[model samples]
Target: MNLAFIQNMGGGGIVTILLFSLAYFILWVYCLVDALRSNFKDPNMKLIWVIILLFAHGLGPITYLILGKNSKTTN
Candidate 1:
Protein backbone atom coordinates (compact mmCIF):
# COMPACT_ATOMS: atom_id res chain seq x y z
CA MET A 1 0.00 0.00 0.00
CA ASN A 2 1.39 3.46 -0.99
CA LEU A 3 1.51 6.47 1.35
CA ALA A 4 -0.95 8.31 -0.92
CA PHE A 5 -3.53 5.54 -0.63
CA ILE A 6 -3.19 5.44 3.14
CA GLN A 7 -3.56 9.21 3.41
CA ASN A 8 -6.71 9.23 1.31
CA MET A 9 -8.24 6.41 3.30
CA GLY A 10 -7.41 8.13 6.57
CA GLY A 11 -9.01 11.36 5.41
CA GLY A 12 -12.20 9.62 4.37
CA GLY A 13 -12.34 7.73 7.63
CA ILE A 14 -11.90 10.90 9.64
CA VAL A 15 -14.72 12.61 7.75
CA THR A 16 -17.04 9.72 8.33
CA ILE A 17 -16.23 9.59 12.04
CA LEU A 18 -16.72 13.33 12.41
CA LEU A 19 -20.10 13.23 10.70
CA PHE A 20 -21.29 10.43 12.97
CA SER A 21 -20.11 12.29 16.06
CA LEU A 22 -21.92 15.43 15.02
CA ALA A 23 -25.16 13.58 14.46
CA TYR A 24 -24.90 11.80 17.81
CA PHE A 25 -24.14 15.03 19.61
CA ILE A 26 -27.16 16.71 18.10
CA LEU A 27 -29.38 13.82 19.04
CA TRP A 28 -28.09 13.80 22.61
CA VAL A 29 -28.73 17.48 23.03
CA TYR A 30 -32.21 17.21 21.58
CA CYS A 31 -33.02 14.29 23.85
CA LEU A 32 -31.73 16.13 26.92
CA VAL A 33 -33.91 19.10 26.11
CA ASP A 34 -36.93 16.95 25.52
CA ALA A 35 -36.44 15.08 28.76
CA LEU A 36 -36.17 18.32 30.68
CA ARG A 37 -39.34 19.66 29.11
CA SER A 38 -41.23 16.43 29.67
CA ASN A 39 -44.09 16.42 32.09
CA PHE A 40 -43.61 13.72 34.67
CA LYS A 41 -44.93 15.72 37.66
CA ASP A 42 -41.75 14.97 39.58
CA PRO A 43 -38.49 16.84 39.08
CA ASN A 44 -36.56 13.77 40.17
CA MET A 45 -38.11 11.76 37.37
CA LYS A 46 -37.02 14.35 34.85
CA LEU A 47 -33.49 14.35 36.17
CA ILE A 48 -33.36 10.57 36.12
CA TRP A 49 -34.59 10.46 32.55
CA VAL A 50 -32.08 13.05 31.46
CA ILE A 51 -29.22 11.17 33.05
CA ILE A 52 -30.43 7.89 31.60
CA LEU A 53 -30.67 9.40 28.15
CA LEU A 54 -27.19 10.88 28.43
CA PHE A 55 -25.61 7.65 29.55
CA ALA A 56 -27.66 5.29 27.38
CA HIS A 57 -27.35 7.48 24.29
CA GLY A 58 -29.70 6.63 21.36
CA LEU A 59 -31.70 3.88 23.03
CA GLY A 60 -32.35 5.90 26.16
CA PRO A 61 -33.95 8.80 24.30
CA ILE A 62 -36.22 6.58 22.31
CA THR A 63 -37.29 4.74 25.45
CA TYR A 64 -38.01 7.97 27.26
CA LEU A 65 -39.99 9.35 24.36
CA ILE A 66 -42.04 6.20 24.11
CA LEU A 67 -42.57 5.50 27.83
CA GLY A 68 -42.50 8.92 29.42
CA LYS A 69 -45.63 10.59 30.66
CA ASN A 70 -47.87 12.95 28.74
CA SER A 71 -48.76 15.99 30.82
CA LYS A 72 -51.59 17.21 28.65
CA THR A 73 -54.46 16.15 30.86
CA THR A 74 -54.96 15.22 34.48
CA ASN A 75 -57.08 12.31 35.69
Candidate 2:
Protein backbone atom coordinates (compact mmCIF):
# COMPACT_ATOMS: atom_id res chain seq x y z
CA MET A 1 0.00 0.00 0.00
CA ASN A 2 0.93 3.58 -0.65
CA LEU A 3 2.01 5.90 2.14
CA ALA A 4 -0.93 8.17 1.56
CA PHE A 5 -3.35 5.23 1.63
CA ILE A 6 -1.89 3.89 4.85
CA GLN A 7 -1.99 7.33 6.42
CA ASN A 8 -5.55 7.82 5.39
CA MET A 9 -6.58 4.43 6.70
CA GLY A 10 -4.74 4.90 10.02
CA GLY A 11 -2.45 1.88 9.98
CA GLY A 12 -1.71 -0.41 12.89
CA GLY A 13 0.76 1.98 14.51
CA ILE A 14 -1.72 4.82 14.32
CA VAL A 15 -4.44 2.71 15.91
CA THR A 16 -2.14 1.65 18.72
CA ILE A 17 -1.07 5.21 19.31
CA LEU A 18 -4.64 6.41 19.44
CA LEU A 19 -5.55 3.70 21.94
CA PHE A 20 -2.61 4.58 24.11
CA SER A 21 -3.57 8.25 24.04
CA LEU A 22 -7.13 7.40 25.00
CA ALA A 23 -5.93 5.29 27.92
CA TYR A 24 -3.64 8.01 29.11
CA PHE A 25 -6.42 10.59 28.89
CA ILE A 26 -8.73 8.36 30.92
CA LEU A 27 -6.10 7.82 33.57
CA TRP A 28 -5.36 11.52 33.75
CA VAL A 29 -9.01 12.40 34.15
CA TYR A 30 -9.43 9.78 36.84
CA CYS A 31 -6.48 11.19 38.72
CA LEU A 32 -7.76 14.76 38.42
CA VAL A 33 -11.18 13.77 39.73
CA ASP A 34 -9.71 11.75 42.56
CA ALA A 35 -7.47 14.61 43.56
CA LEU A 36 -10.42 16.99 43.62
CA ARG A 37 -12.56 14.69 45.74
CA SER A 38 -9.84 13.76 48.20
CA ASN A 39 -8.98 15.61 51.36
CA PHE A 40 -5.44 16.65 52.12
CA LYS A 41 -3.73 17.01 55.45
CA ASP A 42 -2.60 20.53 54.65
CA PRO A 43 -6.03 21.75 53.50
CA ASN A 44 -4.36 23.92 50.86
CA MET A 45 -2.73 20.94 49.22
CA LYS A 46 -5.80 19.79 47.37
CA LEU A 47 -5.70 22.80 45.08
CA ILE A 48 -2.00 22.37 44.55
CA TRP A 49 -2.40 18.74 43.58
CA VAL A 50 -5.17 19.61 41.15
CA ILE A 51 -2.98 22.23 39.52
CA ILE A 52 -0.09 19.81 39.30
CA LEU A 53 -2.34 17.20 37.71
CA LEU A 54 -3.55 19.78 35.24
CA PHE A 55 -0.12 20.91 34.07
CA ALA A 56 2.14 17.93 34.60
CA HIS A 57 0.30 15.79 32.08
CA GLY A 58 2.16 12.46 32.27
CA LEU A 59 3.73 12.66 35.73
CA GLY A 60 1.27 14.79 37.72
CA PRO A 61 -1.40 12.16 38.26
CA ILE A 62 1.13 9.49 39.02
CA THR A 63 2.83 11.72 41.56
CA TYR A 64 -0.46 12.51 43.23
CA LEU A 65 -1.27 8.84 43.46
CA ILE A 66 2.11 8.23 45.06
CA LEU A 67 3.66 10.96 47.21
CA GLY A 68 0.56 13.15 47.37
CA LYS A 69 -1.44 10.31 48.87
CA ASN A 70 1.06 9.95 51.67
CA SER A 71 1.03 13.66 52.41
CA LYS A 72 -2.73 13.74 52.41
CA THR A 73 -3.01 10.69 54.64
CA THR A 74 -0.66 12.16 57.20
CA ASN A 75 -3.22 14.80 58.07
State which candidate has the highest TM-score. Answer: 2
Q: For all the candidates, what are their Cα RMSDs to the real structure?
A: 5.2, 4.2
Residue-level lDDT of model 2, residues 7-46, one tens digit each, is: 6765787888899999989989998888888878788888
Error of 1 at 55 (Å): 2.7
- In angstroms, the error of model 1 at 25 is 0.4
TM-score of each: 0.62, 0.79
Writing each residue's lDDT as its tens digit, candidate 1 over 6-66 gives 5767777878889998987887788788767656765578778877987887588677667
Model 1: worst 10 consecutive residues (lDDT sum): 66-75
